[model samples]
Target: MAPTTPRPPTMRDVARTAGVSTATVSRYVNGLQRFTEATEARLREAIDQLGFTVDPVARSMITGRTHTVAVVILDIRNPHFTGIVKGANRKAQQLGYNLLFVDTGERQSAEAGMLRELSRRVDGLIVSSRMPDADLSTLRDLDKPVVFFGRASQVGVHSVSADGRSAAAMLGRHLIDLGHRRIAYLGYGAARWDAERKAGLTDALREAGLEPMFFSADSPTLEAGEKSVGEVLMGSARPDAVVCYNDMLALGFMKQAQAAGVRVPEQVSVAGFDDIPFARFSTPTLTTVDMQSEAMGELALERLIELIDGTLDASEEMLKPRLVLRQSTAAKVRT
Candidate 1:
């Protein structure tokens, strides 16, 4: 009898062809293992010849849970989001959850796209913006768990945020206490946050028979801050003290004030929020508010897990912000 041609190859056959153990072949075939390009190509060739197919039922049995938490943020450049991620990471590792971060870069379309697919792949989600409220509501309506970070809205499935209103309020009160009657607020975020903080400032100012000059901006980036301050300093009316959205913007404003030959805390004092890592080292040793970023992150994760496991109802909690005084603000210089 002529030699029989080889019978159709099996997983074992492919494993042998690829010179790897059966376990390695199984991992590669299931996309559970990561290997070098060369090894993956060889495995692909072996599988192609063997005509291997993964059992759907068996795959499901191996992965009991989706094992992923999707973190969606607008601008990763913002440290506020970073703090939240750190908190999520800590809690996720403790619970054996994998974190998958996506930077929407503040794009509404991308935020929408990510939501549609992420709902399918992740066990839960932590979103950081407001535009996807309707999509998130649908997910909640369908029993999917999602939490919003930083910004707050009633429609979010679950929301996590610091007491930003109170934080800004604290800053506002500090300025008022310093006897800064002609104050300016360099603000960012939605009208809601701005309004709340400004309300706090207004409340305090109204008590003191004063009002704040407010400037609204698209964001708290350094350039935006620089321009905002430059314009004010050049104008006929200028604030004696300026409170900024974040440390970066605050730093920019301070730089601009000095460039215009204004003495900080003498001609005009500047302050910022978030007290980012570099805040203390800045030239004037910035006075600012602490949003408790890491704590915010840790709390968010703790809350998200509870919500996902049906242990906690959706709720909103605020963290109290603290004021760190340095060389930035002092008794108003004698005019």
Candidate 2:
């Protein structure tokens, strides 16, 4: 004779054992309605005895809210992205939501796959994408509330970003005023945000009746910055000052400069973007732009909540950038 398996518990079994209507049990369990203390005690006792647990899939089906969000970042290793993720996670938890983060490793092709998979499991999305407008448009069409963290799109997606063009122009003007004419721009290939900063620098150079020597790094990395320094120093027009894409690149160039016995600010003044934490503590502290990345992340999460609740109206927000003066940059030395 084979032993029969024990019958699995159900909501009905809980309601029957507790001597309450199924509707009352359902409402009380889901927190949509309350019952008398006596009824609640009976239900809890029944649930304990039956070992009943609410299945998340069933709960989601009933409430129509997964209470989960997906955030896609370009590079998780970057401190700038770390700040954004921290802000977003804090804000999301306060709003009764959990975050699932994905790193694209700066790969454009990976974005589509991440979106396809995560969109099915999360209630909303927050992305700091480096993809083109055409490729990013697919995300807006996913029928899920989405908020862009850094870049804005023409597809009318909600976004939070810094005015990098103006910030870069300000940095460029500062260098120009400090008597730096033969300036070189060190950065990776074309990104809209990068393009904006480059345009600002180019316009500033044009206004000063000067031209820039452009050096393209393979990627936004310390190694790229180190390798690009050789190109900048060996070029026909040696730059008196250099503007790097971000702090890592700036530090890399500074490292190479030190090894080559080139004095910072004295021989080749250096500047960078994204005033990360170590920027202020680095040897000859890095002069860079503060993009308020954490605030951007918090704002994006707030906007995403509004979107989920159907209260959002504006499609975009632009945060301000500030220039931080540090020891890495100074008036060019006359040599």
Candidate 3:
């Protein structure tokens, strides 16, 4: 027969061992009351000898707080989201809070479902949404504190994001200055950030009297970039340069272009937004924008915690974007 488990120690057992009343033990253990130094020392010794641990669930039942946060993002496979998770997780651990991460797989419909379910279990949320402003507006009714990441909402959700339009305009101006007249844009489907970047790039190009070529992908993955390269190249009008939505897409285009023997920065210059880790290690280091993902993550978590603790005021934060010039883009050689 299996050995019987020893009786788990209780507050009464601790009180008996420490020569204190059970009510005194309960109050001291839960920080509801203070005790004399000698008494506190005796109670600590008793607790240590009993090998007792406080159950978080039991404590939450008494205090009405789970001390946990939910972080919702799209496409965990993307390094940008992973970086945000890392920063957010680090802070959550330091503050004795549990983190629950949910990936919506870039589906706007799935986000509403996640928000509904997870809000019941966690104290607050940090959401990087793919949903439209109208859909996000409904989150105002969610009974928990929330902070939005990477996109702003008209629904008055506290938001933290990098300026995508400025970043795109900067990249477009760089390409235009380098003699890239016919520029192609490879972007993902509808999203506020996407529209802002696209409009910024289009405006920059049009200002220079250049017609911007547009190509789109279902997702912002490497496969999407590889699959769309053929149509972009096979068109009647070929672009001398391509600016991609993100580094992942640009990497895909580079992979396919190299396989087809197209020289990068020689025949066509390529650039992307979001200077992820692989952007620096690529064959020809990618020219891209750094959106400060880690900083964004940290700020988002800080804001969420403040919201949860009733210390944060509703506000919007926009981080600056930096350009990392590299080997992938060059001065176009006019033939």
Q: For every model in order, what is the number of clashing pairs?
A: 1, 0, 0
- The digit string of per-residue lDDT tens for model 3 on 124-230 reads 88988777775777566688888987554466678899999989999899999998999998988665578878988998998899878998977899998888788
Local accuracy of candidate 1 as per-residue lDDT tens digits, 154-214:
6656676666667766777787778787888887765235556667666767777878888
Local distance difference test values of all predictions, in order? 0.74, 0.84, 0.86
TM-score of each: 0.77, 0.83, 0.85
Cα error, candidate 3, residue 187 (Å)? 1.2
Top candidate when judged by TM-score against the true structure? 3
Clash pairs, candidate 1, are 87-297
Residue-level lDDT of model 2, residues 294-335, one tens digit each, is 887788888998998889864668999999889988898777
The TM-score obtained by model 3 is 0.85
The residue-level lDDT of candidate 1 at 164 comes to 65
Worst lDDT run of 10 residues, candidate 2, spans 148-157
Better of 1 and 2 by TM-score: 2
* Superposed model 1: Cα runs more than 4 Å off: 1-64, 132-143, 150-153, 189-192
